[model samples]
Target chain A: MTADHLESRRREIVLAALRCFAREGFHATSVRDVVRESGLSAGAVYSYFPSKAELVAGAVAPILEALTGVLDAVVLDGVRSVGEDRTPTEAVAEVLRRIYPIAVGGEVDYTRVAVTAWAEGLRDPAVRAIAERTYGTVRGRLTDRVTRWRDAGHLPADVDAGALGQVLLSTLLGFVLQHALLGDVDLDRYATAVALLLPRG
Target chain B: MTADHLESRRREIVLAALRCFAREGFHATSVRDVVRESGLSAGAVYSYFPSKAELVAGAVAPILEALTGVLDAVVLDGVRSVGEDRTPTEAVAEVLRRIYPIAVGGEVDYTRVAVTAWAEGLRDPAVRAIAERTYGTVRGRLTDRVTRWRDAGHLPADVDAGALGQVLLSTLLGFVLQHALLGDVDLDRYATAVALLLPRG
Candidate 1:
């Protein structure tokens, strides 16, 4: 296959692997399962992934990257637009509104898989390292932004930026879990309530 | 085995099954794994739970019940303690603080499983039914309390009770997940930050 075709095929395998992982847990899913799911030969799957662990990580990497990208864009862009004039509550709300759609639908299954992996990773050092890297990078960036907001005086002086960051991250995650579990439910109003609760200038 | 001894053995099997499920995904973890983990014979394991699904649900039921208990206690006791004098924020805080530890540490692993199961259940009718029964009861109780709080003018007049309930529930779940993932990180500061965000009387 051409390089471009190879890349496309890789993406296809990853997506199929994600679906399999989401439907049947990662370990239960084998290379053959993925090949059948993706309509690829076993050789093609091997050429791309090498092993189930790598396939699981590769399958989830894009979705994780996308989530991290959205979080950064919304938080950073919101902060820039708010500048020194915006109240923390408004800034927080704007951030939530921008990210709400993504939180509710965009990567819901991916996140569920991520959560599952993190939980499982607790007992396995190798998997735990991957899970930690994935979580810490996203959380670390948010903590930095919250610190900047605190420095700008947009937030209350007593606000622990890192802690608040954790809360904000947790709020969105928990909502996604609930939404994923519940099928259809409006989350915007709930997002607004959380926004209202954040510390203001 | 006597009925009581049989019940004890069953509980042991269920707990073992949870650990196995946590280590290996539900599909990957066989009855053999649970039997091995619990030091029980396969016959003993099968006698307690005829199916793996029942074992999974039983393993998680206590944790779910505990979470629901906290919410119920918060609503009931917060309202009772506040009497005619307390503001909405204070009353709610009273309830929330009481349940914070449960969310963070009590039955945390099974809670993680419950969350994943809830998401997975969306497409699986059997799992979905169990999730709905467990989650719906929690949501319904919170909705009723939020309505009472709003009607009594303890909360913002415009607040959406059902949605707010979802948010609150999600917030607790998210907080628990973060705390669990973070391991050694001190979360007391985060709890304080959350408490500070509450509207003052």
Candidate 2:
């Protein structure tokens, strides 16, 4: 197969594996299941991913990319839209509103997969690296934005950028936990509560 | 066996299982491991718990009780201490400070077990019931306290009690997630960020 064809084939297998993991869970879904779901031979699946951990990492790559994309857009928009009379709180709230639907929306079950990955990360170093990298990337993006907001006088000088970023990220994480564990939440009310965390001008 | 003797034996087995789950993992640890850890025969282990799911529920029971006890204390203190000139925010912060050490401390690893339980809850209905009931109890207690605060003029009248409770719980949940994922957080900074979440008096 050509390089592009190989890459496409890998993507196809990873997507199939993700569906199985979401449906049957990481521990319950075996390589055979992935092969069955992908309609590919056992040899083909093994060639692409020798183990379930590698398959999980492959499946998770797209989610990390999508999450980082959302963070980048939100941070950039927060910076660019300041002149349009938008508050940082509004910007953060907008990010939550936009991301909430995708994180908890129908058919995809991203939260379940992410939660499973988190649990797996505790015992699996490979999965831990992926979880840590994703968290670090999100925290770094938030830290940068928070620093900018402080320097630009949008937030208080005493605001610890790292802590603020964590606080914000925690809100998002907390939202995911609540959604996954308890069912739907009132996003508007959640957004308002989050806004209360912002420094008032 | 006497009822008291049977109760103690059950506790011993559950503790052994908890250790295994904490050290290994829920999915990785099996009934055999629990039996080995507890130094009991397979028949004895089976007599006490029919399945791993039952063992998980048994293991999680104490943690839930401890959590609810903490919440009850915090909410009661938040109410009783109001007359002593402490703000509700201060009461909440105090709770975080007291709980932070225990939640993130070494050896016990409540966060890891909780995260594992959460992941298990996704695939197991019995575990899911335990997780949901614990969450509901905590949220309900928090909602009651928030309502009391608002009614007493400590908080704004318009604050949604349920949302505020959820936001606060999310902060705690977020702290747990961060601690479990990243190891240690600046609890002081986290406490300060949490204080900022409360309405300014």
Candidate 3:
């Protein structure tokens, strides 16, 4: 097959897997589910992705990248330099804004997969590796931001940045869980409440 | 069978299901898994709990009651008369204190089950019904508290109680998720961060 044919086939497989993951969850779903969902033969599916782990990884990679991209846009790029007078809540508001669309507003619902990944991570070793890495990276970035905020005098000197960071990340993760499971979970209101918690400039 | 014997057998079946649910997940676990875990025949299991739904409900009712009890301890009973000087953070702290042992300290790790319930609720209609009621009730209580705080002048007049309540519930839910999955998540630090977020006395 041509290179374009191979790429298209791979995309088709990944999309099919995303659907199954979103509906049945990453761990509960099997390779056969992807095969059945794709309307492609098991052999054809296997030829592209070797196993269930690889299949889920393949399907989830883009969503992961997109989620990271959203975080990077807010946490990494949205932060102003020290003494520039940026409130932590402002960056947070941006993060939630960028997250809402990706979490539930797409052809593939990322948070739905995310909620499963968090749950399945407790029991599935393979899935746990992915979850731990992602969670660690996210938490580390938030911690660094919190430290930066404190250093810049946006927050008090005695504030525990690490603890604050964990709670901050938890709030976001909690929002994703609620939004994924409950159809009408509003982000704007949550964001407002979060802003109230942060120190105003 | 004697009443005591029948009750004991029912408890045995429910306990078996809880183990399976924690290991696999409520939506993913089969009644056969419960039977196998119980070391009892399928007939014996069915005689106690007619179906998977009823089985999970039986398994989770106590945990649910316990969770609500924690909430009630803080949100319901912990609240003092208007003009009584209990900070919102104090009530939150008490709730966290009560919740720690129940969520991760016990023989049955409830937050672990809770994480799965949130994920499984997305697709399992039967599970979804239970989840909706739980989340709806929790959010409603939090919202009511926010309104009470505002009305009592604990919070500002302009604060959006519904949104604040949602975020408040999210923070707690987020704490549960982290605690269940990460194994070393410090509720004390999280509680501290939560305390920082609430209005100071």
For this target, which candidate reaches the highest DockQ against the unseen true structure? 3
Between prediction 2 and prediction 3, which has the larger lDDT? 3
Put down candidate 3 lDDT per residue, A1-201, tens digits, no spaces. 999999999999998998888888877789999999999999999999998878867877776787688878778763555566445656666778887776667778888888887877888777777777777878887788788888777667988888888878877887787778877767787787777767553
- Interface RMSD (Å) of model 3? 1.5
Clashes of each: 0, 0, 0
| Highest-TM-score candidate | 3
Model 2 chain B: ten consecutive residues of lowest lDDT: B81-90
Ranked by DockQ from best down, the candidates are 3, 2, 1
Between candidates 1 and 3, the lDDT winner: 3
Q: Pick the winner on TM-score between candidates 2 and 3.
A: 3
Q: Which regions of candidate 2 fall more than 4 Å away from where they truly are?
A: A1-8, A80-89, A104-107, A151-156, A199-201, B1-7, B78-90, B104-107, B152-156
In model 3, how large is the Cα lDDT of residue B52? 80
At residue B190, candidate 3 shows an lDDT of 78
The global C-alpha lDDT for each of the candidates, from Candidate 1 onward, is 0.64, 0.77, 0.78
C-alpha displacement of B81 in model 1, angstroms? 5.8
